[model samples]
Target: MTPPPGWYPDPHAPHLQRWWDGAAWTEHRRTPEAPTVPVPTPPGGGTGRARTVALVAAGAVLVAAIVTGAAVLGSGDDGGAETRTAPTATASIAPESPGPTPEESASEPSADDPSVVEDQLNGVTFPLVDGWVRPQYVAQDDVVMTTDGTYDCPGDGTVCRHGLVVSRTVTANDETSPEALAKADISDAAEDAYDRDAIGQKPYGGMESHELVKQGPVAVAGRAGYYVRWRVHTAKGPGGYVQSLVFPSSVGTESPVLVRFVFDAGADGPPLADMDRITKGIRPVGDAGTGGGVGSSIGPTG
Candidate 1:
């Protein structure tokens, strides 16, 4: 007789239930315990003992076959009914714990933080002195310049203000010496400020003329470099002193990087001594603080 369309004990092996689609078995099967029903075995006897052993072996083989069939069927449409059992078991398990917070996830050190401020691009670090604040215009990676104040130029002219300008740049070439680079940079900057027809004008009302008061070698993190001191005169009258330093990369490489420190002070602004101290205090990310004295003509060496 044909069975109804539902789960029933396998006719050949009654220990396990198999799905019968009215006319025939459809390959879906489960142990009696799985369906919450106990399979009945024949009364204890020599033949019954053997039959019971055979049923246990057949049940093991049935489980193995089910697993193998599930693997072969994969996620095909025809295997939807077979895949539900595995997912149900998975669903019973608790989900994973929540992850870290947004702040915790983004733990990168900030350059704006004076305590831990660092120039990752140039591989240098320095503490922010009192009364000096980092301006929003200067990017963190390029250079960290903190100033006592800023000069807002009047009208469309690019000059007419006086403040310190500190920055850095990294280059990949060893063809020129540090002193040569410093001289060239200073010359170009002076031309930009003093030359009326120059392509780019300097920031502070374009200096009328500038004289190189003194220039000599300096050092940073034990790496050789050079510094140039300029006595600039602008349209507004004696535009204070300007000091530029070119620091070669301390981390040894064929192509040394350059870190520039530009200090532009008005005739009545901060003393040259203060600028000298700040320049000397610059050290590679982490180094013991050392004091240095400024020279009469030129600034202090790093």
Candidate 2:
């Protein structure tokens, strides 16, 4: 029988942690902070379980639909402020984007393209900088890209990379305010990437602490959106930065899309400028340019 959805430490390897399904280990994992409630299993019943697994296997090829392929809001604090009035600025220039077609739900962009992560399911693409790569790593279904290689984590059980970027649609909730969603998701992003390693260790010693660094409205892929960034201090190594950026889809239903980032702070980490470059370079897929498509960059100011 499947046990439940929760994280347990590995006894033989105290530095490692793993996610146990009732009968075995599944891919996604997390760390506990304070005493916490167990993450409920994604709702699936007797009949649905088999079909859900089968469908996921197929979605693996195309990246699935926005509603099915992205994140459901997780339990995080209201870390961002209420929406603020946008500061006046010149809008970026770009060709208008056409809505994505239903057929795109099955299209897979080349991860090694070195220029863009054409997220057909989410109806947007992220630009890749010099040191990043699209990776298929541990618990990587939602991971769109990461820095070139791994480093020794401060804790045990798993390796660490200097940077990572993940994209997910906020499919579970009805909220559409980008500020509210970005604010609510940052804590979860920090915890997921740093605070705990589902497989066994606290990568940066489990986000020792954090402070909001920036928050405000911005334009992503020509859509109005909001972002929240934080400077996180971990229990070990040089800590890093994490951001949650939320924008609406350009295609059907205009669902909210969530893009999360993680970057280590020291010299070995990816330069922070890449974050801004990536944000500015986001474009709707099937656009005219490849290396540096014209996209919007009006985002939160420091």
Candidate 3:
């Protein structure tokens, strides 16, 4: 016997099966095969595991944001006073606005450009004016200004630091006023150079004496600070060098923004006058306090 067209008897056990279109059986025989065993996963299950992973990722992002915010706030103490009052008006020569030098003209912006000098050291950014070169060596606790270059003039056995510098941590603060900081930094720089008369000296020609000029109270980012530009119109040792100094208000973990533009006196004019102008162009990087753009932080100041 022959089975029906749509039905086929199982040869192995005499069970019946239904035929599909043409190729094989559509319905199974009376006796079916045992189901395959499934592998067991952890109790969490796949969906639960996916959810756990997502939660962990979100948690990590939140932690990172919190850490970043804290870092921005707890980095430095920049809430110093906005002191720009000029020092005692000792005999000083009036400064003429000198134009940018060839080298400076190529690299520095105009006097009105709102660029700020950035000194990044010890994980803090102190904005200074342009024309301020980072010193290779400085006198701060964390920085060291050296005299490896040709000491054009030596005072007390130290090289006359009279070139582009690249020092770390040049700006700093210590519960002091900005004016106080500028004065102290300028004085300190004079001392550091092993020259007593290079910074605070007077007497240009005839009966004129040149003094340090302090200009600022300009908006450094958003915080208030000042730039001190001074000139020493005399000869130190035999160099006949006239020095210019730039000091910014904020301080960092490394040092204050101490910059010097030196020129040998008896030249046409104070060679650093233009340099001072270029330095003046530098403003604070971002706004001073919170609400300022990136890299800005807030601190309490008296």
Please provide TM-scores, in order, for all candidate models, with all chains considered together.
0.50, 0.60, 0.35
Report residue 280 deviation for candidate 1 (angstroms): 1.6
Using lDDT as the measure, the top candidate is: 2
lDDT of 3 by residue, 68-165 (tens): 21111122367654421111111111121112211222233334432332332211223233334333434332221222244434333433444342
Off by over 4 Å in 2: 1-114, 289-302
Report model 1's TM-score to 2 decimal places: 0.50
RMSD of each: 24.3, 18.7, 30.5
Stretch of 10 with least lDDT, candidate 2: 85-94
Give the per-residue lDDT digits (tens) of candidate 2, residues 87-108.
1111210111112221222233
Write down the worst ten-residue block by lDDT for model 1. Answer: 85-94
Best by TM-score: 2
lDDT of 1 by residue, 9-99 (tens): 5555566655444444444444544421223555664476776776776556544433221111235676563322211112212131112
Clashing residue pairs for model 1: 159-205, 160-205
Ranking by TM-score: 2, 1, 3
Query: How many collisions between residues are there in candidate 1?
Result: 2
Cα-lDDT of candidate 3: 0.33
Those runs of model 1 whose alpha carbons end farther than 4 Å from true positions after fitting are 1-117, 139-141, 154-161, 170-174, 191-204, 252-257, 265-268, 289-302
| lDDT per model vs. reference | 0.47, 0.64, 0.33
- Candidate 3 displacement at residue 282 in angstroms: 2.7
